[model samples]
Target: MRKHQSAGSAHGLPFSPPRHSQCGCAPARTERCGGLRRSTEPPPSSRARSLRRPQTVDAPSAPGGGRTGGRLKAVAVALAVLASVLAGPVEGADWQAAVKLNAGFTTMSGITHRGTLGTGERIGIDIDGEIERHRTEDVTAGVGASLGRRFGPWLLEAEYVWRYRTDWDATAPTPTIQAITNVFTNVRTSTLMLNAGRTGPFSARWLWEAGLGAGAVWNRMRSDYIERAVSGVRPERRFKRADTKTSLAWNLFAGISRAVGQRWRLGLRYRYIDLGELRAGPFEARPARLFANQGAHELQLALTLK
Candidate 1:
């Protein structure tokens, strides 16, 4: 009978008991010398042992994860801010106020009537009269101011304009009377209007605006004239206005505005004024009448408060 025993290795693999040295086998390795090994096989090299060992690899960190997420959050916030600004004022926002001062040229046209002696009573003239269409134009200038409130794309305003030395000339026709007449006038007007408009960014530092409106025009006029008769024995007449007259008119206008500061702007405007017909005299106890139609162009400087 032979004796038998069992053995185990740290790697948990089982093997035969080492043969006794008398059986021509190498001695079993001891734990103090780094544990047992199979005598029939060479020990593994360090590189091969490391390869056989199970390995755990750490996953790579995300690429710029925190920094990229931070940048995206910042961009989202900036876009939200910009959208609010372009959407206009919020509900219940306070009203805004503005004042404008303007100066520019004006032109006037239309008809005038003067009677030949004793040709009156028709068309309500008490003396001989002639009607002529005046196509003449003049270089006249004015000052204006306005106060207004804006409502989204609409604006409501009140304005006053003062016009100086608006004048024109015409030649009277035959049968009634033939003559050349010169006229001089002055006008002032107050108006109320509602306008529709839009505002947009023009550049990094400026904004642009455009608008249109219709309103009433009130006119104050003065006249001076020299009339000379043609092909008739009637003597020439020279007159300086001894009185001023008033008329109600209407107008249409368009304009553009540019922002120059936080509360200042510059603007250019064009207007078509219809003063209809205005009458201004009974000189020397004799009946006379002047008819006029007028228009203007303007540039302005404005200040605003919100």
Candidate 2:
């Protein structure tokens, strides 16, 4: 009966906690329970949560952009300079090629060539050849080869040329012998020269050159002499002269070179030849010593490879 009564205490009733607490949850009851137990867990607080710093964002960057920009700038500058340099020469070469051939009169300031008339007569009259008399009026042709290299505005070149001319004439008579005289003169000259000059962006080319050279000029004169024969018969005598001399001479040339197109070059130049003396050649008898100076004019058309 006692055991039944003890079990019946709060047995039929639901589990209960201290009435002073506001929580509906209750501690387990002991026999004749008189105390309450405290909970170890903590309640939720009302304080606000801390915010995380906003993550820093950066713009998308191109890979290798800086280095590529620098390299591209350098390339552009180099190309611009190259283009400026080549532009003028390509255009100038074309025009230079077409009108390369030129013709103009020349005057030689040399002394007269005095040779015995082959009549054994000492003819001392002035034998000066007129400006219209010598090989000054014939054709002037030259084969030119120029090798050049350039650095900045300065340039250098080596050149070689060959020039030739000949003249044949009958000198009209007025004094000693009143007969038509036949004369032939031949001149052959070769030149080697070094040049220094300047060039710019637009095929503006110029050069100054000087040369030391040697050449030979030959003059041949032929005639027949007449003598009064017995009983009004006129006999003829054969008279001839062949004269040649080797002379050391120098020449000066100045010119402007223009580039018209890719393969052509145009140039205009003036030339001067100094033939020291006309009487420098061999004469059968003691010859007269006379000095002479010769002048020339030249033009050129050149082809370029670049």
Q: Which stretches of candidate 1 lie over 4 Å from their true place?
A: 1-94, 114-133, 170-196, 203-205, 225-237, 240-248
Q: What TM-score would each prediction reach against the true structure?
A: 0.51, 0.41
lDDT of 1 by residue, 55-127 (tens): 8999643335466456445534644443454345656433445666655556555655534222543433322
The clash tally of candidate 1 reads 6
In order, candidate lDDTs are 0.51, 0.40
* Poorly placed runs, candidate 2 (over 4 Å): 1-104, 114-136, 168-180, 201-254, 258-291
Can you write out model 2's per-residue Cα lDDT over 9-70, one digit (the tens) per residue? 46786434443255444333333324654433233331111122457799643345466456
Which 10-residue window in model 2 sums to the lowest lDDT?
91-100
CA RMSD, predictions in order = 39.2, 44.3
